[model samples]
Target: MRGSPPCGTAVGCMLLLLLLDALLLFAGQAAGEGIITNHVVVRLHESAHDDAHQLAVEHGFQSVRKLPFGEGPLPLLPPMSPRREANAVPRKRQRLQKDSRVMSVLEQPGFSRQKRGYRDLNEMEVNISDPLFNKQWYLVNTGQADGTPGLDLNVAEAWGLGYTGRGVTIAIMDDGIDYLHPDLASNYNADASYDFSSNDPYPFPRYTDDWFNSHGTRCAGEVSAAANNNICGVGVAYNSKVAGIRMLDQPFMTDIIEASSISHMPQVIDIYSASWGPTDDGRTVDGPRELTLQAMADGVNKGRGGKGSIYVWASGDGGSYDDCNCDGYASSMWTISINSAINDGRTALYDESCSSTLASTFSNGRKRNPEAGVATTDLYGNCTLRHSGTSAAAPEAAGVFALALEANPDLTWRDMQHLSVLTSKRNQLHDEVHQWRRNGVGLEFNHLFGYGVLDAGGMVKMSHEWKTVPERFHCVAGSIQDNHKIQSGGRLVLTIDTDACQGKDNFVRYLEHVQAVVTVNASRRGDLNINMTSPMGTKSILLSRRPRDDDAKVGFDKWPFMTTHTWGEDPRGTWVMEVGFQGPEAQRGVLKEWTLMLHGTQSAPYIDQVVRDYQSKLAMSKKEELEEELDEAVERSLKSLLSKNN
Candidate 1:
């Protein structure tokens, strides 16, 4: 210190000091709990249920709940000091497994719900009454904004039929809805709204610096904003009521929170409409945790007095770069995944072609201006002229569902799905990518457009006379555990005898959905595409290549891929699955495990009855068609003569 160090030694010493400072900073940051408190969820064996709380306390975790409805509850203790972070949940799980009473432990994973982007609203002068009605081409298209004429939900026809969504309620499960908005106030159902994020009775979205809180309001307007009030455009179901479930205000969502949110007030909430999910960034693949999964099952099995709550989810905005097959919520068989179509009746640019998507609805196109987006209510007592994305598409479907519910309040969730299959009309798109094909049941379906666009009039009319579907029947084909190596430009086929569909307790005739839980190891996940062939020779392209997934180490692991294209197909012969690799990634892949699940109606004789009825209706329709043609010709002649005289 007195003589001063040598130049080299001094430099080394200074560098050492800098290293120490950096280490301290990093360690402090890692150990400092920002906003999230450390907590662990533990499930115990049934034998230890009575002493669950005492065991949790001994293990230094507080018992959040004992004998929870679904899972055992134990909240682990925080770190002893702020200087050190809590152990990883996986590590803690291993440690907890040492205890005979502990069954499982999971560190709560943080989730960021997807957010939709919208342009700022511009002030516009309004002179005409119902100013925005003319702009809502989705409700009644009149060639506005270059949109196709007569390409709409046919809500006007439904309204004329006196089915305007009365006595139906849809919960907008988003940030919040501006109930005070002029367009929505009249139809706001305060009794059904709740803010789970803030634990408040009123589920109002909080205003933040970003001000993206208008999402729920826009969705609400699309579902049940009042009609003829002359504020914004009319909703698909104008007379229906909408409630807001403000659960997305926080940045992080837990399994328990989401489960509670989905099942919250299930007795009164007829339909839960959600537009948010894992990021649309293309690289992320995520879904609900086990507790949330169980909750969805419970919702369908027990909610709404055993009628099942209708769950509508957005198909996602990940586009061709990313597929919705990776989205857990949209891919689930329990949810009705709604995709988006443009006003021109083409598949939206951002629409990811997934077999799980049930139907499509109108939304703004990627090439069009935001003004072409959905015109609906916004926050702050204002109305948005444009709200876009699959987010907007879902609530539109919900509104249509509300009308269906009003038409027949007793229709179960599965009945509503059958209505969609029978009523959704196939739109002729100019693009070949949106090619449509008939499923086994003679219903036209497309991966890009699903079962085509929702027809509000058709759904409501059918709902009025809808017979509830037969009880659900399930059959499982044992796992094909063989391993086959797949190389670039190679294809592998696996076949299974599906005679199990004829089992005594598992009676299945025509299929509703087919699921394949697959395990594959590939050099790159994006290089694989899978196709499933039904016993009747109908092909369902379950997975297209994901171009954005470049992870070289891991591939699909028990990832379930589903298809609705197998509808009405016999599940009795040898079914085949083909996996192909298209890329030359210099590495090969192996298919490890595949399990097949067939879900169908147990009514074996219904198909014959349906065929008989169809034949009878076809004979009557032919006679009516000739008469209608003759009347149209006579009307045209009269119109021509009138034009000549004028």
Candidate 2:
């Protein structure tokens, strides 16, 4: 036996030993196998091909996904993640140079809003006098007497002919609107509007009835009241019961919640007007955002009216082949309609000497958008703004949709897409592959201009009488939730919002089935698994999951995929997955390590591994300033305390 160690020595030794053990444990756990997200390259076929399983989210399976048919084109780039904002354009970004996984995510084709030339809207023509906006069936041109669609003149004529668009429900889905605005009162279908943006915050909190720049108000004015009886311009569907959807982020941006919330609503809004889509490339593609979009499409397929429902999606503002789909709200294989632009390529000639072109009547500076002139409603609500782009185009089309629905509320979303294409006088039967490519190319019903400028009169005539789907397939997602709490054994229904305004860009989820995996290792890589069991049991699909690390995070490299499903059901079943050990792996002796993951995640984000990289840069600036401030305060306090002590 040895002499008893000194009390102090023993205590110190014990503490050192404990610290060593803790270090070892931390190292071991950190080196343990982990899970993460993975975005796989995918190319899905459109519904016209009937190969629905190719896409993770399809409209047929979503009862609320109001996507239209004939998805003309997709956007180029996805909108900025709701979690990120361009505080400052960095000179250099940490891009995924050669990493295919990361590069694929970074290089995913999407429209570029930063590029020039795409914003030549000030030079285009609204073609208000074009044949498309005409309505030979309704009446003659404002003065030409050949039957055209005009504002005040045609509206007055229509009223005289008993066409006030009364009894029609026009749903405008956008940022919250001021229900108390004088112009919106009589028409503000508050009972029809709902806010998915605010829970603790009230809708239109400040009564900031943002007049001149309010996107919702401007859009509403175009659709209904530009300034009823106020010598202002007339509305497309004047006298129409314009009910705002009251759901949207500011323009050119969106959040998952906003994207997902479009489907879960209380009232049955017949004609849903969406002047929004994904900020991704202009091509009309679908991904994780399919839930909200698909749900909206489901709403369409199911329809509010006995006849059916129709959802109108705005093509997008970056008109050229850029991200035309604003919020994933483009026409998919459902009862939805997409609106595009058709510019006569003309602009209002403004004399320079009187360049009264003020940004805001209050800004007193050179305006933000100097390029002026288009179909958009402008000053005093009488003239259209010089604004051009798919943003304005989509609303223009939505306005036309309201009119058609007013004429015949029985039109379904499918009728809107298919019929519009088949009957479009501009591109009646012309078909070309000139979608969202950067060629400024077009051919009849090109992707850039779905069915070539929504010809309202044509759609009205075509949809007079349509049929129910031969074997109409319907599906639904659910109420979009970030902190989703899906009950055990219960299904996670998704709300599909494929419109461009709704940013449902890529499908997202944690490892498909890796339940709170408390332990994992490299050897048992395949053991800890997850899967997306499409509601339809249609598993001809691929899955992607990231390989996690000891930190409970997965690196993009160790992505996972699933063997396509065998196939079954129409509206898809639950995506159930289980975790199990294969060949006795994942058993790293309980040294107290946890290889866990979120309970129910179906998405695999490759770019998430490197996101908001600029956040650190911004934080550094703030952190330094804070440190300096703290140092100064400490100095002052110390001086005061020392003097008192002395």
Candidate 3:
């Protein structure tokens, strides 16, 4: 008689309906709506919802649901609703009385942003096995003629130390990674992977037909492909977790989209390995937008349980036609800029020289024969025999970081940098560019290779008992408006004595990075070269002649050129900048304005502590060795006496 007897009984039907309602409510609260997903969130005074609902309804916003924990209402507006976009809120809300129940409204941000040829699976796996592993000279060089026997990443020893990066997570901010690849599947972390291009969760490359879409998968394999699985050679951190962030798949990348991708899942993702950046062309100069900058800062300040997320960036691959300083992301003080060394342990031709570079790692180079490139996992469950570029180098360093993290899980972003400076092996390959000189603190540095090649064993050993650096100290000097005209065959040298480097809460002795913000106008930008010399006599080539950069009228405009070459150097002495023109013709340039920002800390205490620790350990080790020797000598004497008495 009433709705087919209402589930055969009135009371039973009512109870069933109530249970379903409760389940639905629970589900809604659990899967909370996105902040700006066609909804406006508004918190109302207790018991004032009735009036708020009336007002919302009057404005055509349907009070769809209440927020969890009694936070507020998530009201969905129709497509035709006025002020649909969060950025365009109604002006009348401000004029409304204090009792209007509107606390705050902000625009919820959103984000939007390959493979080898075919082959049989078994054959490919066999072909990709460790038979070629020995050919990976970057892992353990056995005197490869052109390379020193141990001029490698020292990863094998780290592996022997039982650190395969078991608990670290490195997010590859690249095109896409093939999660289904046999070599990478075991270590891939799906929870940390995302595709900003399709607004989906999986980050599989859009195209898998050829090697073009295989970049991310290759990079993933380098970071954390499965180990000894008979699938591929192995990754640097073969037991670590790798996740892909597919933001570069889109043709164009906006700042908001990049912000979302870089800062995605900061609480979970540990290290972000970014190989791509703004146009590497010499003429182009670009960097992160405001949102993306904030995102990077947030990542370091909040990620990895507050130890801070590690960011490894490729310095740039525009060496032939551009300088790495032209690329903003690499030159930014926030990143650990990585440049490429060849398998022969020499600087690669395509590797840009920049003061911002932190360290170097082996990669493919044209200078060597048989052209060795990094081998790792590929598309379609296969493996690739070659993957090269600063792209390849960055992931390798990221893998080393993963190993370091696994060895010592509490390393902050700055701690990693400090360890890098302390343990990296300076290349002594007899190359002119790779020559090293002492900084203010007597630490050797080379602009072509930064501190030097990464040493996984040394880094991991240091990480095991490393102490974090002191809080960062900052000092700024100048807007020295030097509108001096620079003509051909002339040079301008500017000097500033850093007296502001000492004060309460503002003291900095050792340096991490120094940024020179220069403004210049030139008739030919490519004809200009600039360098800075610290009081320690460390020279940083801030700008080099870029033959391809021909823009005449506009030079660096308040451009921030950063250098890490002066690391550990005392920041209290006179700093000099030399700008000169290289062109033979009478071309003119104007040095408009420039500023210097130094970032460091009172590192004397930290350095002293480290030295003391090292000395104590060394003494203990020597005493132990002497005791062992003494015991052996005593045993020999006893045995000789026994023999003579017998």
RMSD of each: 33.4, 34.0, 31.9
TM-scores of all candidate predictions against the true structure: 0.74, 0.41, 0.75
The candidate scoring highest on TM-score is 3
Cα lDDT of all candidates, in order? Answer: 0.79, 0.36, 0.77
**What ordering of candidates by lDDT runs from best to worst?**
1, 3, 2
Sorted on TM-score, highest at the top, how do the candidates line up? 3, 1, 2
Candidate 2 has an lDDT of: 0.36
- Where model 3 places Cα greater than 4 Å from the true spot, the runs are 1-131, 143-148, 365-371, 428-434, 615-618, 621-646
Tell how far residue 267 is off in model 2, in angstroms. Answer: 4.9
How many clashes does the backbone of model 3 have?
A: 6
Report how far off residue 243 is in candidate 3 (Å): 0.6
The best candidate in terms of lDDT: 1
Q: 102-134, model 1: which lDDT tens digit per residue? A: 777756544445432211122112122466877
Better model by TM-score, 1 or 2? Answer: 1
Query: Global lDDT for candidate 3?
Result: 0.77
Per-residue lDDT of model 2, residues 1-646, tens digit only: 3676644575456544554555544444444632221212222224322332322132111111112443532212222223133321121112222322222222222222454222222232322342213221112223122111221112332333344456676766766555454445566676667665554223452234544335666566556653334433445665676665555643433445554445544235666666555543333223225456556545754556444556555433432223221122442333243433222211111100000000000000112333222333332323334343334444445555666566656665644544444444332112232332111111132333333334455445433434322222211232122322222223333322211111233222321111111222233232222323333332211111112212222311212221201111122223443333223323221111222211112221112321222225445665566556556655665576568769
